[model samples]
Target chain A: MRGAAQSLKYLLLAAALAYPLMPFRDVYVLHVLVLIMVYMVLAMGLNILPGFCGLLDLGFVGFYGIGAYTAGLLTIHYNMSFWLIVPLAVLNGALFGVLLGAPTLRLVGDYFAIVTFGFSELVVLFLTNEIWLTRGPLGIPGIAPISLDVTWLATLLGVDERWRYAFRGEVPYYYLAMVMVALVFLVMTRVEDSRLGRAWLAIREDPMAAASCGVNLFAYKVIAFAVSTGIGALAGAFLARWTLFISPDMFKFWESFLVLCMVVLGGLGNIRGALVGSAILIALGEVLRVALPKLGLPAETRFLAYGLIMVVIMRFRPHGLFTQVAESTMQSSLIKDLRARIAARRTA
Target chain B: MLEQQLVNGFTLGLIYALIAVGYTMVYGVIELINFAHGEIYMLGAFLTLSFISMGLPLPLAVLLAMLAAAAIGVLLDIIAYRPLREAPRLAALITAIGMSIFLQNLAMIIWGSRPMPFPKQALPAFFSEPALTFSDVTISWMQIIIYAVALLLMVGLNLIITRTRVGTAMRALAQNQTAASLMGINVNRVISFTFALGSAMGAMAGIMVSMYYNTMYPTMGYLAGVKAFAAAVLGGIGSVPGAMLGGVVLGIAETLGAGYVSSPYRDGVAYAVMILVIIFRPSGLLGRAVTEKA
Candidate 1:
């Protein structure tokens, strides 16, 4: 049965990979799909800090912005290769994450959230005001697309000579994004099922109890933040290559909120749910951008709609759509075990 | 030169303190940051502008604006909060963020995105004119009014918090919710009253800020809200006097930083100060340290 289930999962994954290619393959649609995949990576990254570790991170976009700018600057200024710049961006992002997390990890609840929010604002302000380095509001343009040397391999395989792969086109990036997303998803799933994942969950449920049980709260929290930030940076590197642009406005607090909404809407701590959430949110935002004008609604009404959707979702389904079963099971078992342990200790 | 910046900072600080009081008071009583209070402040400014444009007397316009702002605050609690009384703190926090965004966008849709000028005729003739001056430094009569009014409001709030029966009940609730309930305190009523009081003060701040800046815009509340939130945090989240002190300190920091350093870097200085304070003195200047019960 387990082997059958495993095969079924692989089959579903294959179908998903094949489904996007079967359409008419317009570049616009393909670009949206690529964007969705990128955001899925980001949402998964954010989930590590906020969802699993129960840290409220309102400035997640700050690291993402850093990653994009780093990649953009390196490729545009130093003429670095895309493969080389991507890892550098991730490293830069992880270093920043550690810097931010180390000092603030001791704070509890809303204080930590506020500090993170402030950090995010500070980053954007820095990017905007540091004209010499960031070019202020003019933004960096002419970012190069990723180039792969797969042509020789294709020739070796005797593939069709008519196949021309342009770096600017969506086809090459789409496959690249798919591979990254799959890798991130696999790694996150492994981490979630590992000892580290349990430590994170324990800290999230009750930090004091977790600490009493020998889990290092501060270490795990900081690690979660660092890992999540590193992943966000990777997404940023791709985003710079895909759009060929990097601007401070793109890393606004609202972008962070959107990612948070995706995590919450899709069901926190669930990797597949984060993917679904990102797709739905990105699609809805695009649809609303187009539909509001046709409906004779003003542009600002879109924000109103966004706020309403979040409020409604939070009101009705606080645990989100996908994580209901796991939450309930965990809550019940936790309570039962606590009761039993306490009674046994009292009797002893 | 330093005195001039100090005066400017103090005036701005007073306005911030007025708004910060609302945030601190609500938080003190309920432990929930009332995010919509900033929107209430925005509504007050817009309502004042609307009434003055319609030729209402300035005082009457201000009064009507305050009432409207207070009503919106109460309505927010009724619709968004009352149902979620039993919900977790995170849920309430998310809802507050949602309400804040909703109010901002609703204002954008209703009032349009353009900045509206405050009606010149609404100001008293003497107050409209510039007052004291020291060489190039100039102080306006309007600044005096703002300082006086803010001080008066703070005193009035202090009286209510210390002297009134409702004030005692609020203190009781804040100290211990279950014990307060056991003591026959009407928790819901006191919470509602706290919201009303906080909203009124925030509205007053909004009115003063609009008159001071001579402009009102739909999205003006966001930056001010963040600054005020920073002030509240600086003073200690649940302390009233801390909010006032924090606001003044922030105001002074920004003003002096702008005068001595680049204007573009003034906000950066203020936030940097905030981060430093949080790292070194998390309880704030005057706030008592709190221990989590776990």
Candidate 2:
């Protein structure tokens, strides 16, 4: 069963990688897939707070907005490459995360959540009102798409033509988004098994006990905030270039709630669940957007369904579709070797 | 100009106070921020509009709306929140947010998305007239009505909370739920009653605001709810009086800030205050210190 499941997973991945190259690939489907990947990154980033750390952050979209605006403004003003802009955006997001988290992490429970919500709202307000900076409500448009300028490498290799690849359609973004999702997923899973990850789990399960166990809750929480917000910014940077436009309204409170719903739906603390949740919810949203109008309901009422899904899930399956946390810890080669040693000792 | 802003701020503050009490009461009891409380206030306005249009007088319409809002609040608790009483606080909080979005969109569906004028024909002519005028401050009859109604309801709420057996049970529950349940206090019933009381006050505030502005919309609850929660947090999350005080302060600060600092960022003021207050003094002005437990 394990081998079959593993094979099926690889099969799905192989299919995804090949789909863009396939002749029958549709632009609309490709677009939706890329969008799903963007949200997948967001959900995974957000999952760190409520899922692993037991901290409900309602204002995560603030970081996403900051990252996008950082990328958007830097690209427009300085005419910088996406590669350099990503690091700058990520740094800006982590800086804001620390600035916000340092003082606010001491707030317990709902207070922390509300502060995050307020911070996000303020971010939107700033983006909307700071006309001199963010262009206010008009939003930045015509952002340059992600380009691969490897002319230096080409020069080193003695190539004649300048090596520059500009992304035109959704295909490049789809693959780029895939790479981003994979990278974030890898980081999250690795963190989920590391000492820092265990400390977070400790903090989540029992803060006082964790404190007694010599885990510095505040430092770890700040690290978690920086990492989570940094990933959120990474997604935002990708979005700014891919979408080619971003407005303050795009980062409203509703987007934060939507992403939170995705995190909860996929089962909190489970990285794979975040991916699945994003795909399902985004796909469901697309379906409802088209389907609702035919049924004489406004497309906006699809949120009614999203809201209902959350309520139902909370009442019925609060642990989400997946109930395990750190499921990969047991599957690590070190754990496998330990298991073998224990089995041999028992037989002896 | 300042006096006028103060009066305006005071009126707005009272309405916020009304909503804040609901959030504070629910939080005191369940330790969950009842995000749907704001929707109840929104429903209050919509229901009053619906009732007035159906030929009921304004007074009767407002009364009926409050009762209906109270009932809905109770149902919201029973249906959405009660099942997760023993679950983690996050579950209940998410459910509250879910219910909030559900009801807001449900309102949008029921009443079209556009802002509707509170039935003008249903209101008394005197409401729009000046009840008192002095210097640059002219208090409209509607403002006077808002003042009287909010004051009376808050006073009555204080009485219910301080001078009643149910109030004592509620206090007990806030202190410790398991102990209160063990001591024969019906936990769910008190929670429902708290919701009812808070929802009714919130509904009345909604009606008054819609009347003051002469318009109501579905999404009004989202921002108002946050601000009122801010008020509650400002006063102290679990204290009733704290919520009241917080509401007025926040309202005045908001109006004054809008008037003096910047008008376009009017909504940002409340958020800023809430964040500042939470960071500097999470205990708020009138409540106990919020410890990091559970």
Candidate 3:
């Protein structure tokens, strides 16, 4: 019954994915969809660390800014193409992860969380105050749009140059984000199925026990941080190119907190849950953006909604709307069934 | 210039100490970081403003505001925290964050976001007059009162914890809740009392801060709260004297950093010092070495 329900859920999800890819495109709808995809990618990066590894990173957006600025700066100063800057941004992000993860080695729980929060605020301050490098609050504008050079393909196929296009339109960016999301989802799933993933879960469940079992806690934690950073940076780089502008104001503690909310709202330790949470919240934001102003409400109400939702979700469903592994449920039921069987045998 | 800055820093440190004591006492008892403590401070300031605006006497207004903040702090515990007692630590932490955000937004909704000049008339006539003047350094009656009142509160808090029966109950609960409860101490009541006491102190700090800065806003809590949390950590998270010591040290460091280093990064300087302290001494300066129970 559970398997059938899961398959049905997947079938509907597949249809939903296909609906957006249809030839007919609404710019406004596609814009929202693109944002959802972007947030999903970012949330998935965070999902891996806090969800799988159980390390709460309050400064995930610092790596994100590092990635965006890496791509953004190279585009502005070096005239490097978006394609070329992607790998560089990811490397910088991973390096930052190592720098941050190392200090957090001895830390645990709330202490680690506060340190990360401080680090995030420091990052924004650095970006804002360092006017010489980042153009300060003025922001970098007119970043060259990413383009696919298909002229060679056009010549070979005897087709027109119309086949070549820059990734500026909403539909193309949507496809770009979808491809990235698929890649991250695939990698996350494989990693989650691997030994490292199990180790993280073990650590999350009981750090002492995991350490007793010979899992090098520090190394595994760093790997999780680095991987999350790399993926998050990729999303940031994409955001920079897609938006064609960069500013310190765009990356705030609120953004990091919102992403954390997404991970928590979706089931932590579950990949699909992050997607669901991100989609729903981003959709809600887009709707609120249009409607709240019309109702003559202050703009700060959005944060109020986020905070209220977090409180409600946590109070009612502590594990979140979605939950962790099915194996736990199966194991508990199996134990119950075995206990019953033993009782029956004794009676006989 | 140096003297003036030092004077300002010293006064600010005392204020931060007042807020830090709340964090330490609550943490010592419940081990929960009350993120909304700052918002409680914000509320106290706003409430005091409202009371003063309504023609209430200053002393009565301040007392009522503190009580109201205590009540709201209790409400926060009941709403955002009580249900998740046995849940994961992360849930409580998230709830605290949510509560912080909620209170900030609630304040914004209640009092518009613009910074308002603190009502000078709310203070007594003597507070409006300068009490002392040194070469290049001037101190007002209000500053003197802030020190005197804050010191009195701290001393009173110390006395209550060390000398009184409720203080003994709090100490017992902090050491071991289950054992304390077994010994006839109402654990829930003790916890609620700890929150109330801490929040009352925080409210008083808020009034002091609004007077010190002479400006009050809805979002004022975020920075002050974080700084006070840092103070609590630096002195020793659960140690009362540590919070006091840490707040002074942090306030001085921040003020010095602003004076000597870049003013824009003065806030970051506090965090840098905090991160360094955390790395070198995780138990904090005054915190005892805790052996992690497996």
Q: What TM-score against the true chain A does chain A of each candidate get?
A: 0.86, 0.94, 0.87
TM-score of each: 0.91, 0.96, 0.92
Task: Give the runs in model 3 whose Cα sits over 4 Å from its true position.
Answer: A1-24, A150-164, A324-348, B125-129, B291-294
Tell me which residue pairs clash in candidate 3.
none
How much does candidate 1 score in TM-score? 0.91
Interface Cα RMSD in Å, per prediction: 1.7, 0.9, 1.5
DockQ of 3: 0.63
Docking class of 3: medium
Best by TM-score: 2
Task: Give the clashing residue pairs of candidate 2, or none.
Answer: none
lDDT tens readout by residue for model 2, A1-348: 778878998999999999999999999999999999999999999999998889999999999999999999999999899999999999999999999999999778788999999999999999999999999999999899999999999889998779999999999999999999999998888888788887888888788989999999999999999999999999999999999999999999889999999998998787888888999999999999999889777788889988998999999988788655335433467655764786699699
Q: The CA-based lDDT of model 1 is what?
A: 0.83
DockQ per candidate: 0.59, 0.77, 0.63
Runs in model 1 deviating more than 4 A are: A1-16, A19-23, A150-166, A324-348
